[model samples]
Target: MNLAGRKVLVLGLGDTGLSMAKWLARRGASVRVADTRTGPPRLAELKRSLPSVPANSGPFRDEMFADIDLVAVSPGVPLAEPSVRRALDADIEVVGDIELFAQALPERHARIIAVTGTNGKSTVTSLAGAMARAAGVDCEVAGNIGPAVLDALMRREDAGRAAGLWVLEVSSFQLETTASLAADAATVLNVTEDHLDRYRSIDDYARAKARVFSGDGIQVLNRDDPRSLAMALPGRKTSTFGLDAPRHAEDWGLLERGGEPWLAQGANALLAVREMKLAGLHNAANALAALALCRALGLPLQPLLAALREFKGLPHRVELIGEADGVRWYDDSKGTNVGSTVAALVGLARLDSKLVLIAGGDGKGQDFSPLKEAVARSAREMVLIGRDALLIEAAVAGAGVPIRRAASMDQAVALAAQAARPGDAVLLSPACASFDMFRDYRHRGEVFRLAVERVIDAPKH
Candidate 1:
């Protein structure tokens, strides 16, 4: 952990890379930055903030790895890159921001609650953080959900604040270079096919997510996801959360009381599902996972339940934005892969009505076959857009739902509005990346929201 006078190469000058460089420099490490893009988004900020640090842009070269003591890689930069592979072959210590944060935890005196999975990481992380704060604990949520871990650490240090608890929403990409994050409580919410473009297979992606349980901390696993349940290690303390009833006293699940589902721990019902502000069964599972994680730290149940009841859920993930003609409109642009969209579809399935789904984007090489059953069961019509519209269309061709194509988000929204009936819902849950047609998922969600607003104000034709 002694970084003084050590030479470090910071790869990919994004927020993570910049944080790494600043943190290293503060520790007296010799820092240099290299990014594949000639003009990385944060390159100017880096120059102004750390003018002395050397930075190079464009394609990475072998020389960047020379004489480097450590390579702090951004999650966006794959380890498969030639330069990163070269560093590994040379026995150079390569790590991500999370690993560095883990190494610095003793100085911060903070307990970690790490959450990772293909979906619901952000929701669970935010909820856990809220639970801790509601209990009067000084907690900060970071990693993939907010500011980079190192940035949060530095801000606390400069402000002379004692770190209390850290709730992190870690991605599988961050898990790749992280080895020593011994979280006090951790959970792999669920793992489904995602980021296949970077990983060799679904197994590879799942393995990265499993790294969150590296320490002897208590593991909170998803009982519904076999992939998540498989991560439990021998002799490790574990808890489980699912939509079904809990069998163990410490596990979290649901129970039926008065013919309605209630969130429960073991056989004891805690809160009715209708009491929660967040929509969908998936969010109920997320709330259970958050409760399990917070409860593992021995946080009081009352505040945790209070946080869950007050939680509005995150934007761009099954957020209900507008209602027009009795057709509800949802923006789930964060459904950037097959599993998320599948969850959204299954979570919102109604017996009285169906969904008019707006989906399609980069697709990210996911097998859209899993979506077929969900679509057939939930959707009345489909409006596709983005680069892989045809691929998605072909995959769900026999879902017994009408599929239409649109050139833009506006067109997609119009088509969905047209297809939806008074009781039906219109959802923008593109099961693919937004880079093909939009800057990012938030941008895509914003566009969808604006388009929905337009429909809501169109004189109700």
Candidate 2:
């Protein structure tokens, strides 16, 4: 963390890599940035952006790993990567952007409230940050949500109001490499099968998520989740939340006796839940998780709810693009897994009879039975796309739902738009990976957005 003239070799020139290198260099560290994807478009932008940092190409060199004080890695790069292995062999420290930011924080860089899970991290993290901001506390919000941690730190430093609080959406990948990053409070929303391709097993994935509580912080766990409920951290006092808690949570979101938003916190008066423009019951869970953090931090929830009501939402995760005739179109390109897809489905609040589902993507090693059942029950028709489209189709077909396969996302979107009737919902929630045809979930989301725009904006049918 003390990069005072230390040689820091950043083993990727991706956004986080470039930003970390620039930060270290500014702090008087001798920074060398190298990327295997040297021809990547990002490389040119990185070079132009951080022209001051020493840079190189090709695989990580032995010398680069041998004597460097620390190796800051991209979350996308697996822990078993050749460069990371070399760093391990050399006994050099390997950390993530989260660690670097945590290390660089001033004595009063705000208490960190971190949220991590396979799903719901972004929503919860953003909600917590919004809550803090709503309470009139200045915050530095970053990590998996937006801006690299270092970039947010720099922005705050330049503004002179550096940090009163930090709300971060930590990822398992980021958490796996962030041994030194700690927060004042942490939440593990829920754990489910995901990323088995990179991780050793579900337990390994859960272990990485458990690392979020390592900063000796207060742990906020989801009581409704078996994985979360099963977690044990000795130094961390665990507070649990979720709709299914025996005693309704003191810091939780609940529908009022009627159709009103309310946060129930013990025998005290119920806090009205923010009237969310963002749809879904999963978002209700997200709102509760954020409210839990606010209570943990001893802040008022009113502003947070106010902020959340206005929060349009992160791009691609159940984003509403347009309405054609009376049919509403939703783009949930971020639903790369069943849990995400389920969340997307739940957030849209679409009853099964009136929903048209667009799903399919590069299949990771997860069964589609749950999504299959959800589709069969909730969806009137299904449009499948991506590499695992057939598998999803088979699963739903087994449950007796009608399905159609598309050659591409656009085709699928067009089909759904055409097939959809007014007063129905056309939802794009691919419960699989996006690597089969697109670069990432964001790319898949963008294409879904464009396709939806085309369908909605097309001359009135």
Candidate 3:
């Protein structure tokens, strides 16, 4: 991991790139920072972080790779691009920001919990961080959630920093180039076919996600996921969990008994599920994973119980937008894949069994058959929108289901509301990306919230 006398070039001048550049420069590696967006305004903050290295703008120069030993890529840059491809062929060692951070951490006494999944990765990572902090253990949470991993590492480098647990939310792209990163504990929350356009096969993407964990460390998995269950994760004591697993060590959950969520450890009762502030079954799974992670580290359970009782939830994750006229509106923009949408569908319980499913968006080359079945079995009606509307409609239309199409979120939400009745649930769980109709998932969720607000704020005539 020593960078002394080595020449490293970091592609992309965003947060991760700057962090990589700073870390490499501090380690005595000659670093070059480049970005496609060439302007001082494009990278003002990054320049402040590295004043010595003149911000070199534009694509990777052929001459830069002439003497460069390795190249660290920012997560935003697609690896399939011709520029990135040429650099790889030049024999330069390319790694991600996470791998660079892994190189700087101490080898022992610190447990790194790496979490990856198509959905719920952010919520699970944040919840895990909250649980660890509540337990009074020295823990720092970073990576994909919000703060950059390098920033977290820089914070640790301050005078008299203590040893603590590091919780990271990793993505598929990051995992692909992330080698030699052996986490003390890791969880593949669930895996489904996602990012198909980027990889050769769905198996390739799953393999990339699986590499987040080391063979020797503990692997926490979702037993409900067949793909996760089928993987032969060797060299580690496996800690498995599902909706049905007990709340014991290596297995955790809150089982419902007589209208209450009960925390059970192998047939023994531990706590009540009613005491938790988190809503829905997906959150219960997240809470279970956090509790299991704590148990794996032998941390006391009281703090976890306290945190679970207080933690509310994050945005865009099956969050309740409004409930008017006994009809519930849900915002689940984070369900960016069919597997995630299916997970959302399974947990929703209805008294009259009426559900209005809002789906479709930018296509990700995923198989729509399973999603189609879930919609057919659960949805009373379907509201399709976004660029992939035809693909989704074609998948569900053969099931003899009724569908209403819209050109925008406002139209779609209004149409769904008009098509729903009392006791019916309107779920905005697009099984694809939000890039076609909106800025990002957050923007999509915000639009959903606004639509619901309009419904809730209407006159009671």
TM-score of each: 0.99, 0.91, 0.92
**Model 2: CA > 4 A from native:** 40-42, 45-52, 245-256, 259-262, 267-274, 349-353, 457-461
Winner by lDDT between candidate 3 and candidate 1: 1
Candidate 1 lDDT, tens digit per residue, 1-461?
99999999999998999999999999999999999998898999999999999999999998888889899999999999988998898899999999999998887678999999999999999999999999889999999997999999999999999779999999999999999999999999999999999999999999999999998999999999999999989999999999999999999999999999999999999999989988788888999999999999999999888888899999998998988778999899999989999999888884238899999999888999999999999999999999999999999988899999999999999899889999999989999999999999999999999999998898843
C-alpha root-mean-square deviation, each candidate: 1.0, 2.6, 2.5
Candidate 2 local accuracy as lDDT?
0.77
lDDT by residue (75-101, candidate 2, tens digit) is: 877879976886777788888888888
Model 3 clash pairs are 247-264, 261-273
Please report, as a residue range, the 10-residue window in candidate 2 with the lowest summed lDDT: 244-253
Highest-lDDT candidate: 1
Candidate 3 vs. true structure, TM-score: 0.92
| Total backbone collisions, model 3 | 2
lDDT tens digits by residue: candidate 3, 1-461: 88888888788876778777877888898887777776633377766766777567876577766677888888877778676788788767888889888876765357788888776788888888888899897888899886889877876786458558999999988887787777877888888878888889878888888887754677788877776666546666778777785655547765667776676656655667657666567777777777777677777888877887888778888877788898988899988888788777766643335778899898788877787677777788888998888888887767767998998888988889888889888899999999998888999999989988997787887
- Decide which is better by TM-score, 1 or 3: 1
